[model samples]
Target chain A: MPETIRDPADPRLDPYARMRERDLVGRSGRFVAEGEVTLRLLLGPRARFRAESVLLAPERWPGLAGALAACPAPPPVYLADKAVMSAVTGFPIHRGVLAVGLRGAEPEPGALVPPPPAPVLVLGLAGLTNHDNVGAAFRNAAAFGADAVLLDGPSCDPLYRKSIRVSAGAALIQPFARLGPGRDWLALAETLGLETLALSPGGAGGLDGPDLPTRALLILGTEGPGLEAGLLARARALRIAMAPGFDSLNVATAAGIALHALARAQGRLVPRGPNRGGG
Target chain B: MPETIRDPADPRLDPYARMRERDLVGRSGRFVAEGEVTLRLLLGPRARFRAESVLLAPERWPGLAGALAACPAPPPVYLADKAVMSAVTGFPIHRGVLAVGLRGAEPEPGALVPPPPAPVLVLGLAGLTNHDNVGAAFRNAAAFGADAVLLDGPSCDPLYRKSIRVSAGAALIQPFARLGPGRDWLALAETLGLETLALSPGGAGGLDGPDLPTRALLILGTEGPGLEAGLLARARALRIAMAPGFDSLNVATAAGIALHALARAQGRLVPRGPNRGGG
Candidate 1:
């Protein structure tokens, strides 16, 4: 059933109001999608689950009504006037639609990638605090055949509107989990028999010459401050070869190049299901 | 000269206050940065100019006074009480210091890339609204041998605090300019006699090929919509050779891989300087 909301102070909008209070729907365990395009993409067959609730600017999207009827289990769709919506969201609702969902249980680290022909790129959350990096990390993780992404230390939530938007919904599709701090992540990768290759430009060896194993965990830190020194000491620091007169690429971009090279070296391509869009 | 700010409501903080008001600040060309490390990087040798003003917390650092003394045109550093500093910034100023700088001038479209003995990897601004992508593009531009960068319409400013921080301060160092709609950036590339290659997975030609140019503009768009159909129609689409199984890498990561591969093909090595702190 669709409910029309006329008042900004309505009690039914507690979840939506809470979302406004926190600047996002979920504080730690929830993800939110804004805009009809992103919502459509998330609700598409490729996503893991249906949205918990859909908030819409009634006047902006006249066509959304038919679309909602088509969903297998149409979640609650909240319709509000643009001004009231803006008043609650604290900003003009540009997208006119927002979808909220739970942060599903993350797959166990080893479960993301098997010890086979495919190499898994494990992005280590080093000193990166930017939400965009975290989102881009997920995007790169999906692109480079990383089995899953792990995060540590004040990293942005993948489900955050900004991160999801930045990742182009790649964060929603990519397999990711938080492994907490360095010690915990290192031990898990070791137990999984993954060759942990830490990416650092200061490393003694370049990425190409490394004697990496088939099941490699390519650990990367945020830019500027690469891997934590202790983390670097624990993992093998390797450099990605660059063009003459270039310094270093962004961390996510670096990961992409490394992943592409490694994937080519392994001679395998990742396959997206039927829902894989144009690419 | 440095000033001590004991009150949060001091009128001097008016300019800095715009940082939080996204719409106003986005319209006005201004951004903010905090922390000594970020300030130091932003103030490196290649940095064009000093920030407008700085808000600092007292007694946090005894040694920083010497560094401030060395600036050619030192900024207005305000030593504020912790509570007062937090009140003005609308967030806890953890860096013990906050610096506000006027966004620099945008570069002319053609001026972005330098005359190349070095190859230029130009990141196309096609419907990329995410600030992170803008930031990542700068990071990639610096990592690759791109002499300059160009920004198109509806794209976020490279100097936005999010972008500046995301690019690891590369946005300041890299030569970047902006272009308005209908200017036809692809046409400009053609006029510049530079090979224009748009990164698209749909392209028939693989990225690692014999015909790769020594000097090229590697353009990329936002994730979903990909490249604008009009622009893509004009520019030749080039796909990065990926493992058969993967769908596609994140736009930034793809650029990274392309930059690495193309740089190698062009016989470029990563430029090294005193500032190559890739930890």
Candidate 2:
């Protein structure tokens, strides 16, 4: 049986307190997952993140027991009524379930680039500060089968609670690396033999029907100012052919389109099921 | 010179006060534009929407003189100090600019399907209650040169303030029609010579590569539970090939990729600029 928690101020509730995205404790490598879908993913995402504990609205406890029991070492489960749950979180905990997790170590950014014969597709995200955009990008990358994702230049933590939920828990499973000053992208791409492609609103190269190199690094940029001028110029800049008289597509949507095409060109996005239609 | 206003309770403030999306008066065909980009689009979009009046913070007037001056018969521009503006709207009005415009009359959903001669690419949206998804869908339609958009099944008003803002004001420019009770989509598609295609994850057909008919109506369903099973059964259902274990992509991102592919196949996504890349 799960422990029944009556006190909102219990020290064990620290992970749930006033947890806005900016104040999340994910920097220490621990993150929160809200909603049953996310909590379910915490148990079996085919990844290394380990759930430390869970708190659930009383109604959800029965349904989630089997998944929790399946864990090699079962995490403690705490049950609370809605009022106490809200009081503990300092906000309405509407999703009815939450899990705290510990993400395993991220490898060196350069190490994600596969050596020699194996073809690789890696997404380089730079200066993507918005948590939702970062999450959506990861979701897209996962859908398209990108081998790994690397973040640089002020990117948000993929483990940020909102990022994890928004990504449908994809952030937990996808192989990823965060590049700090210790890792330089320019030298790294060169050493990995990757043909770097940068998406731009305006560039000499069109994005639609591209013959992509076998080993490609598709780098996305900051929302408004876009990739640094030097990076845009240094990479093979590609633009999504947009209709005239309209502003650009939303960043996440643009990434979806670009990733879909690139994944198809690399044969990573081929049919997993028989009914795959050619669109 | 623009009119200077100071009172939050002024009769003219009715349109801006406590404007929750459901209570918005945009159903009467007049809509509000927030932020500079939306206000600018209201002034000069190549669409039939006409700016009726504008409200601006005093500090923004100097920068916007040219766009306002270019209006053939300038709409009255109301200027207020930041405090007065915030007070009038019951929230922080940080964008410093707003405009109210009158959208043109909507045609029957069937009218959007082309008559005998011209090719048509239309998007039929059903059961999409989220304003952001509706807005993003319209923006993608506009970017891909979709001929028109049609909404059915209790969809929210496109001209709702948040919808307009989220769409980057594309809602004002895209030709859209809402279906009334008497209209039936299956009948409408057949009458217009359009092949109806519905997007579903467990669809009979794959979405990647296809020769889309010139006159096609691509319909999207709700985020969860999807389209009514009856509706899915009636339409030619298509699925996007996703990676083995990941959750499906966000609805808007899925729409963008599907729209890009459909538009490209129909040659509706040809670039207006020099850097056109065929996806």
Index of the highest-DockQ prediction: 2
List, in the given order, the native-contact fraction of each candidate: 0.44, 0.40
Which run of 10 residues does model 2 chain B get worst, by summed lDDT?
B270-279
Every prediction: chain A TM-score: 0.82, 0.90
Best by lDDT: 2
lDDT of 2 by residue, B214-268 (tens): 7888888777767777777788888777666673688878888787878777776
Q: For model 2, how big is the CA root-mean-square deviation?
A: 3.0
**What are the per-residue Cα lDDT tens digits for candidate 1 across B10-116?**
89877665356653447455567666755765555656445787777787546577667667777777888778877876766666767777665755777666565
Model 1: per-residue Cα lDDT over A141-205, one tens digit each: 66655667777655667777788876667777667767755446568778877777777777666
User: Which candidate ranks first by TM-score, i.e. highest?
Assistant: 2
Considering chain A alone, report the TM-score of candidate 1 relative to the true chain A.
Answer: 0.82
Residue B51 shift from truth in candidate 2, angstroms: 2.0
